[model samples]
Target: MPSEEHTGKSQPPVRSQPFPLEFPGVHYFDEQEIEAVKRVLRARSPFRYYGVDLQGEAEAFEREFAAFVGAKHAVAVGSGTGALSVALAALGVGPGQEVIVPAYLWVSVVAAVVNQGAIPVLADIDDTFGLNPASVQARISSHTTGIILVHMSGAPADAPALAELARQHGLWLLEDCAQCAGGSIHGRKVGTFGDMGIFSFQMNKNMTAGEGGCVVTSDDRLAQRAEACHDLGYARDRNGRLIFDSPELCLWGKGTRLDELRAAILRVQLRKLPVVTAAMRRSKYRIRQALEAFPQVALRRIQDPDGDTGCFLITTYPDAETARRVNLALRAEGIVTYPQGISNVLMTDWGLHLYYNIPSLVHRTSIDRAGFPWNLTENRGLGGNYAKGACPAADSLFERSIVLAIPSCLTRSDEDDIIRAFEKVLREHLSS
Candidate 1:
């Protein structure tokens, strides 16, 4: 017989361990989008070179998206990078200017500033891995021309405070909506708060057009500026003829314009955004609740000053080492997990690759410097030189973080599989 102490005390057996399970290979598509693409292909009416069909479809998409985001105007572009570039150019950010950005945001946001010949002053993010207005305010100086606030991972970072900071400092605020399209803060849409808001319709985005983007703003002058900038800075007279009749002025602009086919596809997707967003919300909530039960995982809070969130989950592990281990283990189980990209603003966790990774994607003995000039050609007012350093919070969170995709088409089984996978790996790591 066991001692009284051992006999009286009892512990429950652990439930079956959950492991990350691979999701079924199912495709999610709306029939309307397919037919829309087919229609564009059949017409084949000179879709390129900015024709009437392209303009009309682009205009229609712009209107629909602007209305959806509660903005007065929207301008379509070839991609999210193009949208940010034109928006910054419209704001008159150019050489020698500086823009404050969160270090942990997507590299494209920082590149947008650098492309404008302006300097990118990296600011630290708060616990949510987003721009903290105080940190941004502290970074402002005489050369600081703009603030690019990103809603990283679809969580609405505090916009009102940042907007107020920008106003007080006389800084132009450009909202990077690439990750948080269709979201809102304090009942206002995501793209309607700042001087300019840029959205991505890249294939992976919630509102996809294969490869396209748009800029939203209430200011008509800014809208026209962006429109002309994206179209090679050309102006048309009342009859739509080039006003500068000087054939002698032989200057051309780059082609960053959205095509008609993608515009039509965007229109179809735009109509389904609300439905898709709703589904994503439901799945994210369930997965989050399940994941939160494990103390080892720190999920990003959706306290976006915008009240909505969708499709992906970003979470931080206890530290970079743990994050690395869990990510590897999850991958072995066929679960997709990885760190947030390199952050220039994250002084403590600065990873320069996030800015120039595409150009130098593979580690090679010879670096390609040919793309350097082109990479730094656009303007959104990031200029001037300053010391580089580390941001403790951004470094800790970004390096030790994991991002998971929450597809709108996920079924209950898929969601359960995700939850189980997270629980299993997290528990195993924690226990060991």
Candidate 2:
């Protein structure tokens, strides 16, 4: 059997007969990245703690990223989850409040809400694999205080609709742009449309610095709150200079500031993001055009065709059974696809952890052992059941969907192999 390394790095040359195409690895670090890291080390004083240097790589990164996203301020944090938690906390989402989140997203989204002592009401997603505005409206309750819209798989969600919904309900809109750094909607960036937007620079994200995140916002108060929350409630003046002597601390803040080392590395990655995202977009377009012959397969809906970051290519089959069969066939052909069902022990027992399945959240016995947030006196009668069919759209979507990770570094031949594999599989399946 070919090892994972061989499959991802060096597969046999493309041939008439189908051969596995090497998956594009993470962005390669060259002299620029090396120099950035070296410069940080040479400085030896990358700390952002109180009373330390203020102008550093982290600050520079915040400025560059904020400018890139067209936001007035950006607060650098330790990770994407940290950014979410800080943003929620800064926005005043607290105990007894409900924050609507998409059911089909990384578990961290749920965890961030949990960490903030707020309830995460799971909402279903439409074909875009993002929070369905209708589902979001349905999930909104008297207790609902905010909505976290995830741009899943780097495809921009219906931001205009979601934004209007937030306005109508007076709910805070937090855009989770973890998978969509360069993604835009109608020429506007994804992270700039909400009250506050958060981005991830984790290893797998479109723009990465090993592991980091930032919160961007045009709202001055929200930005200051996020910054203070990220740095242990350190008060900041109007100019965002840290104020050490403020008597009032708004909330219990966590120390989740981004360090200088990673920030330095991110500076280099940020410069390369546009080029990488463009390549991924071109790869997606080529694959989509190639698959047009197969009417049985449909690409995931894009709310805005021109706004996709092209980090992932998701398709749906005619039905669940056919989707499962094609998934298996594609794997046999060494083309990776989203796994079907609970295939292993981890997935079987704890698969819900991947997205913190709503049912698990409602009946969280172990984590809520103290009965604090889930069953607290303040939250009594607030907790509800997340039954198996709670989110029908999201449930059905995952079953019939096959997600292919589109690497930014895909070569022309690699893209060709991916297209040919899909065509070959669909031809055989349709013919049979």
Candidate 3:
């Protein structure tokens, strides 16, 4: 706690109880979800493709999710990481190629690229906390094959500009919508903006089934490739048998199939997603409006405010130290910034999500001692600097920005408690 002498103002009133920090989708579970899971279990058909009494929950979820996101097709995967690898393999991002990714992203993003035998080139993030188009352009080379545009937090990235860039360079655009599953830009859902897009229903997402995700695409051939890559390295006939006629078009499977039990829960969660996002958005907007009087703190730039999932609120201070002080004050006030992964909330903690802190990527460690991916025969001369100052803009941004998650369920008092803390803390630390 900062002493009154250090702060130049008396400490504000603190909450008597700890804030209710919770997982979003979990809050909305009820009898509907319980009955859905029971139906799957009772049928004894836990698998989606085949069983004694196949419930078709997985197939139904995929079809509904694809339609909701405005995509022609969707393939359910075991997890978000599974979806990422499937999308990369579908795009042929392997051996000697590079994929441009934002420095502020999930660690699994790089893992997906490396698993495909491709390299991940870190790019800076702008005020949007999304990929910087200029940085991506500067890094593109003959070895570059695609751009993985991540909708960081709850908001959509600048997909139109990135899509145009991809078209001009003839590179595939893969949208990482794990953070922004129901997000959109001007009413066009996020997952449909790229040639291939993926969403996570992990426990922490806007909607969840504990561990599940899906890949969506409008391209017929790309959809086929993703299906084959996620299943058995071959296409299945209508009667559920593998067909070997299209050997040239076949992709090696990673066996990332989604099961019937998870699919049933996800189906219920999907129906409740709009409501989940709406509640969070309402609370977040109200909080931001109340905090606007403090000019020292700026809100994150959302391309479409209404389209955001509204789970995370990013507030930026002028410098690193001030950001640190304000965050400490908030915690002292009994406010939980982000509970799922505390490291991601303030961007203060390292060795978690930041690009430079990734030991394997920064040190260029590969599966083999000879540096298989980095030192592969086709990867000669392809390199990147993953040192501390590689992405200068993003490095500073992380230090200055503090993210807070808006719970799926919040009462009026809950909202007021947040605003009260911001009002008290910002006035003391941010007042000129």
Candidate 4:
């Protein structure tokens, strides 16, 4: 049991642990990262120069990351959302088209699809918090151009199944690996399972570069398109040098470029990813083992436990009411729970309030008040209403689920304490 000395006034009156287990900060920088940034600063020339043939930090990081993920080509971009938008454009997703995405993901996923002048159709998720293949199949229409399969919270979705479905329908498959860096399924990494994959190096992600992203693909044409689309559609040669004489430009291209400073920091962070993911996996396993005795507490469905990056531990309760009670009990014991959203946007206990459910996309037919996309009579019929029962499975799961952010740097003692806290709370609930 935790001692009373650990209790704080803000926390409820319960046995307090010495360390209040809070979610780990996103920016976990070390001396190496600081030194890497300094080195880039010292170079003074951070901009990627064309026709130089010399590998800059961004290009070098791209090559290293490509090799690490077993991809033939890697294109670094400004951010994960930018990576997705560029990849979608590369895959030819444009107006009057649709892209299927899981309902449980961050708003950025939907935003990326909408930004392409396409309709984002929200699909239901399975117990793994990933897009259900059957749901995806059902959601696909004649206008559906692609599917964005997200590996939610470092857990690999049924990529093999999703891949087969995409192939059968002849739809482009894009892996949203924003949260699942260093994660794999079977023996293959999550990003490689799709035609093209995007990764985020955001501060809160498993890997960090403050704000950066990458698109990896083995397809030559797709790689070229992504490269061109990321840099305002500037024509580049085989060596990624700009062709100033080219009259061609990507219509959907944006100036989303990854700088050398972030690229340098990412290089150092990339090398340490395996070690960090391993530690997280160990901590999650320890916590899962401790909670195994409680039948009412179900661990999140993981397709490959060994392959999981273990960035988050999600448990489901028997019912939504039961989950609510446990949430209060845990908080009373000074245990932290996952926030509904960033800042102060509180999500409903049933999880009905979601990014897709916002009136702009759901109730209103047009993306903008001017009704540009929806006003096109051809597109009006394509847009679907995202009502309360839009994704029942995801809503139920969110209501019953308690997500815990697993830190990459946890000691054995810290893991043990976490296990103890969970066990204490579950036992109390079960007895009651």
Candidate 5:
């Protein structure tokens, strides 16, 4: 646990929850979002860039989102995973090169590498539940072209260190901000820390439009490349028409354009992002503050407590068995850890989030029947292990830790109940 003055507060009374916690932005849905979508529908300009009504909501959203994250540009895409693919493509990360990604990241990260016809080398995460710079350094080789730094669980990774690491080795750094849209580090927003950053607006994210995403970057050339990659493999000319003059700019694209309906909805959600993150942060810190009395367990390490977006609270017990028993006790008291129907708190149940759990990755599934990426002459000896024990530290930590989703809609009473339940459970087990 990080050093701080222990609160030493006594346990409060536990009460039945008013409701279970849920994703942040969904709780604040109001007429603004509905009206935004209504405006788009009324305009009949569902397409972005060149709509019939030309509402320009998608372009406006990209501008606002770029300014919001302190980046020069933003490209609205079809999904978070598509943004990853676009970023990898923009950086020219394919065939014969490997991209180092955190083992504790979404499957899309690895899938993007494979889809780009590149190898993905897994790097262990540190206590921050993010990429360990030292581990990344050790994995770097001649074939390494870039590193994908994922900021997980609404907390910023050690970006400054990782950015410097990438610089020292001359590798492109792409920050995955899908889980932490509005998070920052030392007051600098997360997405601007690396060469480029990606965000998601899926149903379970901090903000939601059902499903949407964007990529942010400060580089002009890369931004153009990303725009082309998200479109039809053709860079737009100055007059805003597709141009196929240069072979460098005429690469194959994914056709991942952002529709105006989702863009209109996201414009409203983007404005409310700070509010969503702030509420969860307050609730999270208060719970962590109360739990500081328990010396027997530790909270997951954070790069900056002030910068944490605070969607989840992770506590590590001495062992996996103790963590499991404590969680069962909490649930018996009507205090759930994760939201209903979601059981990704433990790594064993964390489906595709962990590399080893992904069947395609573990089995080295081929994209084409020809088995190009893995069987290619350039990639023959480059396959890194993707078995269960490949990332021992991350696996062990997840097994011994309990994650509690902190909803932005939590009331003071809700926060008190959660703290009391943690107090009750820990007192019974750790007071020994």
Candidate 6:
């Protein structure tokens, strides 16, 4: 048995072999997660929580989570979407305002902006799959209120530059950590770079409570606003009473409270986060080593100045046909791969077309005029979206990219299986 210390630093030598046979599905949860849920069920009050009961756990979690993210404060919320909604509301974003977001992202991100009566200005992603600050700068109108930078798949956005851009332009920043919860850049956490950072604890996340999320900030006033907005616009009075029935409460409020049960589960999960993060890094290296020498497939690109990477493995292809073949091939071999297809509620989706009424950009339009361009490795015979004419670069990645699950609990043998499975898929596909 390899101890954490031994396995932690062991980076396998680069090689190409038929990936090994490993079971396909993920083992995301464990006894520790189960016990945490059990503790929540055993709590004194459980679900029927009040102001202080919820706030107390929130405060504690906020402190711990803030420390984890290297921020001054955090505010736990019901979901990652709720965190965005409340954070925007707390920042006073409303009708007649505009918010900038990447075109390629989880639908909830754009939904949060639109739901708040604000218009979403879509910007194209850069080579790293994050918001292009240049595109952001080009899209800024007088009505622009904020920028929601989603650090997609734990790849940190160009934080320092983006932060400076936001500050220079006097725009609010909301870091979306739905996928990259524990990711950091240059020895700093992802979410803490913006005005208010949001995190999701959805079942599939690196750290999860089945379904919960949080927001973090360094500003005291922002923290108070988040609490008030999440709790029907009620803040505690000096006498420990909710300061509702006041002129302020009448002005702003919403009910998106976090109950005690989720908090209890989260507390235990927080205790396990450090260990989980370490294992995730190790597992990522395992896959990276196997894929390093393969020219037929391109592994997901990650740039970490500190030599760290996210837990999951993402591989991009050149076109949708290749992506489909690779995905089908992997699935047939009992190894699952998630293609980076457009979200269900994208602009072209049937329902979204009617809801947002988004129009297609004109031919040769300046969509990528100010954005950085990036293309995935082309040899994989995967990538371009067969439907959307050609974004050869974006299409290639989205059409053929693969997402493999790597939970923190995987054993060394399991890790080896994952590496081998990927190599097997690539080698077979390449030879064919």
lDDT of each: 0.67, 0.75, 0.87, 0.77, 0.85, 0.63
Give one digit per residue, the lDDT tens place, for model 4 in 173-204: 99999889988998799889899999998876
Q: lDDT for model 1, please.
A: 0.67
| Best prediction by lDDT | 3
Show the lowest summed lDDT stretch of 10 residues, model 3.
336-345
TM value for model 5: 0.94
Instruction: Summarize candidate 2's per-residue lDDT along 174-193 as a digit string, tens digits.
Output: 99998889889989999888
**Candidate 6 lDDT tens digits, 1-432:** 212242232444222222221211113346765675565555544542344233355556767888888888787888988888888988887666778876456767766765665666666556676777887897787778889888876567777778899999999888998777767886788888899998888765667777788988898878888878876687766444677665544335556666666776677777766566677677777777787777756765566724243555666655556656655555444343224322111112322212122232211112244411111121122111212432323433555566655555566876676666566557756643
Question: Clashing residue pairs in candidate 5, if any?
Answer: none
Model 6: lDDT to the true structure:
0.63
Stronger candidate by lDDT (5 vs 6): 5
Ranked candidates, highest lDDT first: 3, 5, 4, 2, 1, 6
Looking at model 5, report the run of 10 residues with the lowest lDDT sum: 1-10
State the lDDT of candidate 5 residue by residue for 45-153, as single tens digits: 8888665687888889999999999999999998999999999999998789989999889998999999988998989999999999999999999999999999988
Off by over 4 Å in 2: 1-25, 49-55, 236-244, 247-250, 337-362, 365-368
* Top TM-score prediction, candidate number: 3
* Cα TM-score per model: 0.79, 0.88, 0.95, 0.89, 0.94, 0.75
TM-score of 6: 0.75
> Which candidate model has the greater TM-score, 2 or 3?
3
Model 1, span 1-432: residue lDDT tens: 112232222422121232222110112356887787777677763254444344456667878888989989888899998888888888887666767877656767766765665667767888766788888977887878889999876668888889888888888899998878778877888877789999888765777877899999999888877777776776445443544663432223335788778888888888777777777778888888888677767777666532556666676777777777666555444453224312112222334423223232212112236443224444223332322234556656667787666666767876776676567668767654
lDDT at 26 for candidate 2?
A: 44
What clash count goes with each model? 21, 0, 0, 0, 0, 15
User: Per-residue lDDT of 1-432 in model 3, one digit per residue for the tens?
Assistant: 324454455554455455555578999999999999999999999988888899899999999999999999999999999999999988888998989998888888999998888888988989999998999999899999999999988899899999999999999999999989889989999988789999998988999989999999999998999999999888888666788899755669989999999999999999999999999899989998997888878888888889988888889999999999888777766676333435225675634468887888889889887887898998887759987799999899889988887888888898898899888888778859
